[model samples]
Target: MDRVKGKTAIVTGGATGLGFAIARRLEQEGAKVIITDVDVTRGKEAAGEIGGLFKQQDVASENQWISLIEQVRGEFGKLDILVNNAGISGPVQNADPESTSTDDWERIHKVNGLGVFLGCKHAIDLMRQSGGGSIINMSSIAALVATPFITAYGSSKAGVAQFTRSVALYCAQSGSKIRCNSVHPGQIRTEMHDSLLDETAELMGASRDDVENDFKSRIPMGYFGEPVEIANMVLFLASDEARYITGGKFIVDGGMELGG
Candidate 1:
């Protein structure tokens, strides 16, 4: 864990949920961390609790990315890790391809797809100067399996997977020490889950308990994964421990992706 001591990292959407968990893990591993998110209140609270810096950033905004990297460079001097974790599920119940509007699709793509692209695009420059870095793009199980209900969500994640691979190869071909990888997670209990639970229950015409049970049953582990578990995987990849790993997709879904 001390391998990351004195290293600097940035976790996007680090205010809460999986992002916050990753930030805390990176800090615990001795990395000087900065977390960015649009949620000012929660972002500041999480940063204060973790003893890291928090900045307001809308991942979908291309213009802000330049400023963001500059800010990090000025304060931290170098960037060793970049976690592209800020994403939205996109208009929940209406996420079906046919049912989804152009606006919804564009918005989701902006954050989930373009955001990761821009993050890596800017990060590589700073990282190359520092000799090397790791980029972890947060994908979802939806990227691999077809989730009939949330079309936009699935499409955006699919884009993330490919983008991660493309960047990895680019870095390799360029002879840069930087690495890029994607982490696909299954359902984890978070505020985002709370927002969808009732609606999802209604959509499936099942009780909330039944929906929760159904999700758990899908995982061979018989339980939902903790965000920290995913965080641990990311921490390893961001550290020298995974120096030889790149362009790989790590699925932390507890066997949910086994069947279909």
Candidate 2:
């Protein structure tokens, strides 16, 4: 208990799925958490249940990001953890570069790419003032591999990975106590996965069961990871125990990315 006692955290898109899991785990470990999501209903409920605060936020907007940080300072006095987890997988249409419309690319990049950049850039100021904090960016295995069907998604996540490394280096060079890292989760069982599976099935003209099995078979563990499993990694990074770790890419993929 109290693994992150007295810490203050802001988890963008914390209303559901992996974001909710991260928020809940942070709360359980004694962080005073503020969960933000565009989904007001669910975000408020989740925050209330965990004894935290909820705010409607659109991470894609620079204006919203500015206001959120200011509000966090006014309410919490100091920010300790910033989890940039808000993102979209982009439309799964024909997703190859040619089939991917400019609209799809722009929309996904705004949230998944630029939003993360804004988060890291702004949060670093507050974290430095707090005498250093952790920045956990939600990257994905998609960033490390090619998935033409998820062209926009993979590209945005790649930006995240590189951004994470750049932030970590900046902190280290400046002799700051701040640490930055990225978490790459693969095939986690969540609404997002369900949607991805459904889309893949439709795209491939395969049964949903067949699509799911194909995904599972790609994992050495042959199963989808639970939300909490990914959350635990965030918890560790948020804790002081990971003081020595930074600029790291922690892949939680059940060896799916491993070569045979």
Using lDDT as the measure, the top candidate is: 2
Q: State candidate 1's TM-score.
A: 0.97
Alpha carbon deviation, residue 169, candidate 1 (Å): 0.4
TM-score of each: 0.97, 0.98
- Give candidate 1's error at residue 200 in angstroms: 0.5
Per-residue lDDT of model 2, residues 39-58, tens digit only: 99999999998999999999
* lDDT value, candidate 2, whole model: 0.92
Where model 2 places Cα greater than 4 Å from the true spot, the runs are: none
Clashing pairs in 1: none
Q: Tens-digit lDDT track for model 1 on 38-141?
A: 99999999999999999899987878899999998898889999999999986567778678889888888989999999999988999998889999999999
TM-score of 2: 0.98
